[model samples]
Target: MTLLSMYFLAGVLAVSALAVDFAYLLSARNQLQVAADAAAHAALYYREQHDAEDAKVKAVAIANHSMPEDSYGAVLRAEDIEFGHWDYDSQTFTVDDFSKDAVRVRPGRTETRGNPVAAHLFAILNKPMWDMTAQAVFVVFDPHCLREGFVGDKVVDIQSNNGYEKGFCVHSNQYVSVNSNNTFEAGTVVSMPDSDEIELPRSGFESNAGLQAALRNGYYRLRILNQMDRIYEDLYWASGDFLPDYIASAVPITVSQKKLTNADLIPERVHRVNCGGQALQIEAGTLLHRVVVVTDCAIRFGAGVILDEAVIITQSTDAKSINSASDLQIGRDDACADGGGAQIITYGGLEVPAALKFFGGQVIAKGNVSFSADAGGIEGASVIAGGTISGTSNMTMGYCGTGMDDNFTVPYFRLAF
Candidate 1:
């Protein structure tokens, strides 16, 4: 009877040990999974800033510190890191040397026989260890680039007197008002939250509040602009992710910005910059690779003003004037001519010609983007207004993908499933 009791006690002790060891293994796995997630995101961010080789180096470095030195009882090595694409259809990760969009990482590589979680009491029964693993995948996307052609928080009014070309997409969170005299080209989309309220000129609404997630959330891991004015500061640095190709891909301009005091820049200069976010006059037929930042000031355009390879940012908080009005004034109605497009951003209200044409740059304002007269609207341009885009007549916005090295795109990163 005493021998039987001893055997029962031994069996109970072994079972308890096994349970304790299993808990430890689970904790280790959770730790590894967290490390891999952080590492994968860091790798993708690095890839955008630098080359692929530098990206891999950064991924491994971040993974090594995510878990404690003895958390998993093994140091993370470079072999565990992988550069690849996350397949949407197969729900798998595929290795690729030239992969740019996605990154994959495995902190505790337990696929092989040797890299297993060492067991405690289970080992006494010849079940010495068990395999444990965790992995993470991350992908990169440009929020500003990979989205609808026209986006408005309140209302998206497509009251063009002319017609919409193919491949045009318009989105609004609140409402979409399509006034009269508008023709919907084949494959044009008008997305809004309340699909029933959508006013279509010819056909039915092609898209709806699918963009609600993007509008409400900033999911990208890097280069996000929460405020409307943040876009201006980012133009100075490539890390901010909105620098035009003209400046980023150029041979490093000795000067990126110039200071101007309500005076027009000389058009003939090759690459002159206007800094200090001061107000300036962009005369008609002005051509140069320059950057203009306007702060707490107003900008007037002499009729027929043209900006080539240029950036214009207006930063005004609340109201710059005593009368509660925006300090920025764009172009006059009769005196209008433009080409080679410009990048424009304003924190206050903006007033422009009713009929406009821009060869593709960014135009964002905190206040209303109103028109002066009925005219042919924008072509190859992105117009974003915090308030209403009040205008009528014909307008054509051809989505020009990264044209003339002057294209600017906002980027972000996040875990992809």
Candidate 2:
């Protein structure tokens, strides 16, 4: 009976030891997963501005920082980091040396790496040592609104005689209200939270061709204006200004007393103007090229003003933060020129001119956007507003993917494993 009790005690101790080893294995796996996730995210971010080789180096550094080599012994190797494209529909990742869309990181504490997790009970039982690896796939994507379209947070109300070109997208967080005699070309997308929630006239379907077929139901509640602060801060720092109020306290930029012209601005330098609650009115035929203008007041453009490779930002919340009277051209010509486009970011509403032409340009407003006249011609035109997008008769716009480099795109990251 005493020998039987001793055998039972030995069995119990063996089971307890196995259980402890299992728990330790789980803890080690969690640590490796954390390190891999961090490494993948850091690599993807670095790949935005660098090549795959540089990105791999960055990943190894980040992984080693999380798991020291002396303790974990090379959990993540530079060769194990891969740049690739992740297909959402297929749920697969394909390796691509030149792709910056996704990054895959494999971190392990395995026998091959000479750091296999020790298993005392398993070794005593004549079992294999613990060999584990953690995989992380991090991806980056741009929002549809920034891709090329008109996105309104509140409502999108369009009047009669409006024409949208191919690939032109219109989305509203709430609803879209449209009047009669409108044409939405093929490949155009009009989206909202609910397709049935769109407001239309009695003969909406019959009056507008492709309107019924173009309606899509989706939800995108991106706070796009929040990005303006980062852009503003970046421009401020790039201008070599240490103080936030340095540009705010400076004198107003003018050419002839109250007016501004080509001579008033230097294309190579960043110009900051303190309007002091007044307007910064540009003279007629003023050609602003390769410059950045940051101001706190409204901007009024004279007739026939042109912008090429330029950026105009206003922090005003007035009714017309950026207003044009006669006409405004946003590029060098009809064909898109490399490094020749313009972008306008305003905190208030945008009052578009009679003929708003765009070879490649973007208008981002924190408030509403009122198109008083026709806006067509060329390509690469995007209008994003936080409020409503109303007014307009006979409006047309195009999308040029490569020509929109001057425009800003919102980026986001996610971890998929």
Candidate 3:
């Protein structure tokens, strides 16, 4: 009986050891997995705001924080982090030197030398060490050109009964509301990143193949738009020696009286064009050659206002209207090589007449941009607005597709699968 009791006691000790050791190992594995997941997510977000190397560093740091040194038998290291893309078909990951879309992280592993988790009880069974490894993968998503046409940062309201034509990408940052009777052409996609307040007809707003093809193939990204201030100055505006230091502070120059003289333009200073809070009206058939500036005042382009590679900027604090901005022959004869295209930047809303027609140019504005059907619509033009972009009557405009560098970039990064 004494011998039997001693054997029973030995068996009890082994069971207790197994229970404790197994629980510890399970808990440690869960912790490592959590760390890996966290690291992958952080890496993707960091890649969005910065370059690739920085993103890897960010991921490693986040993973290390989750599984601190000595928290487990092994420590998370930078070598455990990897950048790559995933193959969904094969369910595999391939490392790449140039890809910023995917990030992989391994929190803790016995693969590292001198870093094996020591088993407290399992050693009695000729197993003194255990290896633990956990991994996670995350991918990033980006949009292409045919995916955008009218992108508003705040609000978008379209009540046009005539509908939208093909080859136009419409995306908004806030909400998109399309009223009744407004149809859509083939290859036309209307997307909003923030709210799901999209109101459009499902069964063919216009009943065309082009519009339907766009809807079937295109995708949407719900995120904040990237800033385009630098692109506006560098790509769209005058560059190199033609780039000015600053336009001096001067009263508004008007062809209202006569053609602008040399006194109207300040040579060698191109960055600043200052109109001292006064309205500027370019008389009918007047020719403009340099960048023009206006501050909190109306800008009226009279009949046949011809621009010889000119750019105009109007900034306003109050809500004032831009009167009779019509009948302009801008950047047509020069072939748009000097600056690629004539440009217009406005801070306030534009109230244009029916005869508005712009050729080979672009408009970047902070307020609503509206065009009328009384005259011809835009041709080879890219118009960007901070608010609504609409026209009261049905009009035709050809924006088909511009260079990606031409559009304002709103960098949005997100996890893909």
Candidate 4:
């Protein structure tokens, strides 16, 4: 009986030792995985602006910070950081040094780096040590609705006879309300947080069969709106160099008295026009090209005013920060083509009453945007508003996949794997 008791004690000791070794191995692997995840995220974030080498350096530092070299023994190397593109369909990462979309990181403790986790009692089972490698892939993505469309934080109300072209999108964080006789072309999307929350006519779904496609889950938050102040500061300071060519006026620049012509903008493509809380109205038949007008007052585009390759910025919070009459052209070329596009960035709302032909350009507002004119030449033009988008009718808007770099884009990072 005493010899049997001794044998039972020996079995219990062996089991306890195995448990300790398994727990230690798991803890080490978890630590390595945490370091890899953090490093991948850091690398992708820095890669947005820096080169590949700089990104890799940042990743290695992050990994080391999480798991010190003394403890982990150089778990991460600069070469272990790879720049790549994460394909959603194939769930694969293709290495590309030029692409800044994704980053892959490998952090590990292994025999190769002389950091293999030594085992205690597992050596009795011919397992002297354990090796672990943790890999992480981080990617940046942009929502399609924000790229080229009419996106509103509040309601998006459109009247009848309006035709949205292919690739065009309209999304509202709250809800989207539309009247009948509107055409939503194939490949066009109108999305809200909830499809049942969309306000439409009685035959809304039947009339617009494409409305079914609009029933997508989740709402896209406009992160760019929060960064507008920073964006404004950058544009404002960059215009300081060409201050001498500013519109020389303390009062408003109106058509009745002081009208502005192309001659007012000279030598440079950017200019600062401070109206001292007054209005800045361009004269009729004036053609401004490749110029940026930064002002603190409201802006008015006179009849037949062609703003080709131009940008108008207003810092006013007035109800109508930007207004235009009939025959106001914003771009000079095709919507999908590059170059010769105009943009209007307003702190308040934008109101275009009639015959506003805009192409290959973008209108971004901190307030509501009302376009009552026909949507001729609206392809490649994005109308984004912080508030509601109403008073629109008989307009057609299409998406321009390329040549829209000027459009405000907010990129977000996610762990793909």
lDDT of all predictions: 0.55, 0.79, 0.57, 0.78
Tens-place lDDT per residue, model 3, 1-417, is 999999999899889889899998898788778887888888777775577778778877776677655654345666777778888788788998567768777766584545667778998888888888888887764364322355556555655554566665566566566555555666666666533455555543453334333442223342321233443343224442223223332333333322233445443223333346666565666665555433335577677666544565555533343555556654443322333345556666665655665555555666777766333445555556766776544655444344222333344344443
Deviating ranges (above 4 Å) for candidate 3:
1-59, 64-110, 113-147, 161-163, 173-175, 179-181, 193-269, 280-315, 320-324, 328-343, 355-363, 373-376, 379-384, 397-399, 402-404
Off by over 4 Å in 2: 1-101, 107-134, 221-224, 237-257, 414-417
Can you give the lDDT of residue 254 in candidate 3? 34
Stretches of candidate 1 exceeding 4 Å from the true structure: 1-39, 42-102, 109-128, 132-135, 143-148, 160-162, 192-224, 227-280, 283-295, 318-341, 371-377, 386-388, 402-405, 414-417
Best by TM-score: 4
1-417 per-residue lDDT for model 1 (tens digits): 999999999989878887898888788688778888888888887887587778877877787677544554443566676777787888998888677788877767353623567777677788777777777888876554223255565676766454555555566556677655565665555566666666555533323222222222111221222444455555533325565434533222333333233243432222234434554454544443454433444655544444555666655533321011211222221222333556666676556643344555555666666543323434455556566655546555454444423444444677886
Backbone clash numbers for all candidates listed: 16, 1, 14, 0
Number of the top candidate by lDDT? 2
**Ordered list by lDDT, greatest first:** 2, 4, 3, 1
Worst 10 residues of 2 by lDDT: 240-249
Report residue 233 deviation for candidate 4 (angstroms).
3.7
lDDT of 2 by residue, 173-277 (tens): 999888888888988888999989999999877888778888999767564587788777665444322122223323333333346788888755567777788
The C-alpha local distance difference test score for the whole of candidate 3 amounts to 0.57
The sequence of per-residue lDDT tens digits that candidate 4 reaches over residues 1-417 is 999999999999899989988998998889899999999999998887688999999999999999989987999999899998989899999999998899899887889998988887899999888889999999998777877787899999876778777788888899988888777778888888987888989887777656677556558767777766765765566532222232233232322223467777642344667777678878788888766667777888898888776777778988799998887787775646776667788989989888777667778899999876556657676778899998467666666787666555657788999
